[model samples]
Target chain A: MRRNRALLILLAVAFGAAFLKAGSFPGVAAFVPAPATHIAATTAHVESRFASSKLHTQVHAASAIELKDGTVRAFWFSGSREGAADVTIHSAVFDPQLGRWGKETVVASRESTQHGLHRYVSKVGNPVPARTADGRLWLYYVTVSLGGWAGSSITAISSDDEGLSWSAPRRLITSPFANISTLVKGAPFLYADGTLGLPVYHESFSKFAELLRLDRHGTVIDKQRLAAGGQGSLQPVLLVQDAQRATVLTRYSGSEAPRRARTMSTQDGGQHWSAPVASALPNPDAALSAVVLADGRWLAALNNQQAGRDSLSLMLSADQGASWRVVQVLEDQRGQAAACEPRIDAALRQSDLAVAHAAPEVYAGYRDSARVKVQSGGACNFEFSYPYLIQTRAGDFHLLYTWNRVFIKHLHFDTAWIEQRLREAAP
Target chain B: MMAYTDLTGLAGVAFALGVMLSRLPLISRFAVARSWLVAGIMALALLPVSDLSLAGYVRGVSGDLSVTSLLLLGLTLLSRAHPQRQGLLLLVAGAALALYPAAMGLGSFDPYRLGYGGYAALAALLLLALWHWVRGNGLIVLGLALAVSAWALGGYESANLWDYLIDPWVAIHALFALGRAGLAALKRRGGAR
Candidate 1:
């Protein structure tokens, strides 16, 4: 009888506990915070490594554009790294009206024995496709023939029918290796006289940004250095307002303290530039991108953190690359608590103090959950880096950034969203 | 706060009841009963308010299994044998797996990010434990506890060897519960026979 009473008490306790647990279900609903009120204005789609054929792997350094009939076209390189024997240029188009990316087509590969040189070319890098001022669509990309990224040459293929077909790839012969200077980050600026200003960069032992001028018939007339010296800067993005005055934002590659962003200005139609100055931004020695806003502002995508790439930030500069105000934080992964304690415990068990010291650095670098910095009024200290921005005709900003090297995140927002937030802050 | 409040209340009640029940010799007598108690403990650990219950929190800290899912799955299948075979297979597989990161000079890719969110880590760990249990090593019970403790602590960088050895996954808990329940059902039927 006494045992039965004890059993009854135990049953009562279990029932009571389960009742309370089930009652707590409402609490689970409260943990999820409210979603963002404004939707992103710009939409970004990733053209991953194998958007085309599986037979040939290795795809990187991509550029895209949205055509007049709402067709989005993208171009990239495929082969075996930067200097393998099987490198080739590939292109794809996205028909937005039909809501599908077109079939992947090969644009250029190694020339046949009848048409070209004997040595095997390994890979290609950095493809730039643009519509010229005369309505001719031009595709300019690099092919590496001999060495690493240093022994690369730029070539062009034109399509008069908006990429349905293309002319044979022709070597530009832009550099000293008879066409072997790395010509990348090509953005065409249409001069008042209908000429083209191509922003190119060299990446031998001395990495420098240069501006090349070409006639309408794809003839290279002249060129000049935008920023010189071996600061390891490449990808000079040009923002030209008129024929004479322009600004070029170059990605910093040097590994020194207070990492600088090289910038220059042309006052004489791609003739001369002011000495490149390091901007007040921290770069962990990686490539960066920038684009001009329609309102005459500049948007830069880069790693804002001093040491790691965990924080990718997007900044808007009213003055050309001088000072930047962070518009948004794309990714900010904080560390987890559950996994940290036992790792510390294991370190203690092993009595390895050295490994323990390095553990925190490893934890900080690998933690995937990131926080977006939204609180305003002070200079944005949050990390927002490696940004690529494109402004649409509908006045929306489309931005894409590498989210901790795990995935690429696309952020789209409009001027109205910024204006609305600013108006709300005025009170 | 209410979610946390409910979670703490439920956990406190369950823990207090478990402690009280465990004091009674009758409840502790049977292995099947003890296994049920373990299931209850796992459910308690999953309270929404607990740090281990968050999806992104776990994945970021624990890593993902997407890249090595096939390999882990294969190991899971191989370990489901008799106790001696299970132990041997686990040792061989564990040694190979542990050395793979170092040998390839490949840094730890967070496997927690790979699969469906929320229960991925729990599932992977449980599957691993099930493989151990089927081999009848009986060390799976201890492993389950260690794994849960490691996961609860957020698997952070500390001076502890236990963190690297165990991981909390749903499959581990479910497998333990299922295996114990299956054994209990078999014994009951056999007694009748």
Candidate 2:
């Protein structure tokens, strides 16, 4: 009789503890902050071009941010080749008045990352620099410890004085198994409470996009997968309509039948997402950038082709991505201003075959000509891809993209330019 | 934060050492043999041979173990009990053999997804917890305690539920323990011939 009484007491305590735990904490609700209400100086069409990276090395996948001091800082990885040991993250500050980019600063290296992680690092790539709500700049990049890109980890470094100095690098615990295979590409958005929502992809065995919700200190708080299982999609670009509604445009990765850019939406601020459906924009398995403009419209820069990066264009969507139309042909392959030297033809099976087979002299010519084009401000026709867009407080859109895999071309324009282009393309 | 994460794995190594030392005749003489064994392991984590402690090296091999694994060790050590259930051991073995290879890119259908808002894994864990309770084992209670504490304190670096429940080291150790027990049982049955 005493033992039975003890057992009843134990059960009561267990049930009581569970009840307390289940009732104490509340769920995360969608909290959307109000948009900025300030007006810019003007809405006229104004564009300025500059090459942020001056290195002749293989440069790609650049991200940028406009500082509080009115300086535009751009960052990308440059090395002898992609995933090379000598690969380092390079940064440059753009002087808006002088209309030129400063000398590149070698910010992060493989040695520094290995030292911080206390593990052997094989290579590094894809540095994404962004300004937090508190005015500090945080840079996140990928580092491979073993195997291919599937064995990669994300590391972070913060800068208080813009891109001048940085804090010690620390690895973000993104995965359970040695933290491998997770890669970041899209620009990180934020919640109303200063939480960062970074879009990451898994490429180990599955190609899908996941939104990692992190605290202000970069600790991952939660994760929600945007795409799962089937139709291979990755590198999602998030566009926020408000606090409760957002859309992710993912680059379709189906090689056999490359179709339009796939899209998914979240009605509850990224907590839940709809199944990814193909949108009305073609993709060639390349990185793209999308943003929700201040005027309640959507803008995206993507390779509008079925299977090649030979063409890139700007598309506008006014009906919340339900329909889209090409506002401007940013780069055209059939035009006379197409990239000439590294010509992709019928014999070239791989899309990056031209880059693989191009001679040093050919790459040098493309680099030198791209530098000249940035200065002279003419048509940009050389393999301009991997575009990242950011709108500043002055209502100007800053675009940073890879130019022929040798330079990071910075293009600053306004919404008026997009409006004019849409008018010209209309019937 | 990284140092804290590295040191948390010492709990796993310490428990493993304590379990081994408890089997020795000389060490088991003291009434507090298990406590002394755990204390010695804790000393190894704190003692600096030159500059780094032994905890650093052990953590490198056994990444960051789950809180559930650590709590299970504590429960066993405190109660001086061992639950020998073939069903639970087989479940752990199946998870180890299945997840380790797939995570290393062996096959498709990543079980890692089951950690991120996947319902099937949570359902299975619930069923397992119910089974443990019905069998009068303390593992379910300990698992619940660890899961609650980790969730409240944001214990592990990963936000995944699987990372909070199982890690590679825990899975492999469980498999090895089960394999050793099976071999010993086979020898007693004269199955080796």
What DockQ, between 0 and 1, does each candidate earn?
Answer: 0.01, 0.19
lDDT by residue (tens digit), candidate 1, A1-427: 4544443343334334433433322111011111223434543332212123323244555556556664656666666543555656667775544434578777766552102211234456667777676888887777665557776766677898888788755445444222345567645555556556677777665677766655677655444556554655567777664445677777777776777666677676554468777776666765567666655677777777657555666667887667877765545533434444343344222322232355675433322221112112332222233454555555555454433222223345567655554445444
Question: In model 2 chain A, which range of ten residues has the least summed lDDT?
Answer: A344-353
Candidate 1's DockQ = 0.01
Over A77-152, each residue of candidate 2 has an lDDT whose tens digit, in order, gives: 8887788999899998877766677888889998877655544567898988766658778998998877788777
Candidate 2: the clashing residue pairs are: A32-A243
The C-alpha stretches of model 2 lying farther than 4 A from their native spots are A1-26, A31-50, A131-135, A256-258, A333-382, B9-62, B67-88, B91-136, B139-156, B159-161, B172-193
How far residue A321's Cα lies from its native spot in candidate 2, in Å, is: 2.2
lDDT value, candidate 2, whole model: 0.68
Candidate 1, which CAPRI tier?
A: incorrect
TM-score of chain B of each: 0.28, 0.70
Among these predicted structures, which one has the highest lDDT? Answer: 2
The runs of at least 3 residues in candidate 1 whose Cα sits more than 4 Å from the true structure, single-residue gaps closed, are A1-58, A79-83, A95-100, A110-120, A241-243, A307-310, A333-387, A400-413, A417-427, B1-193
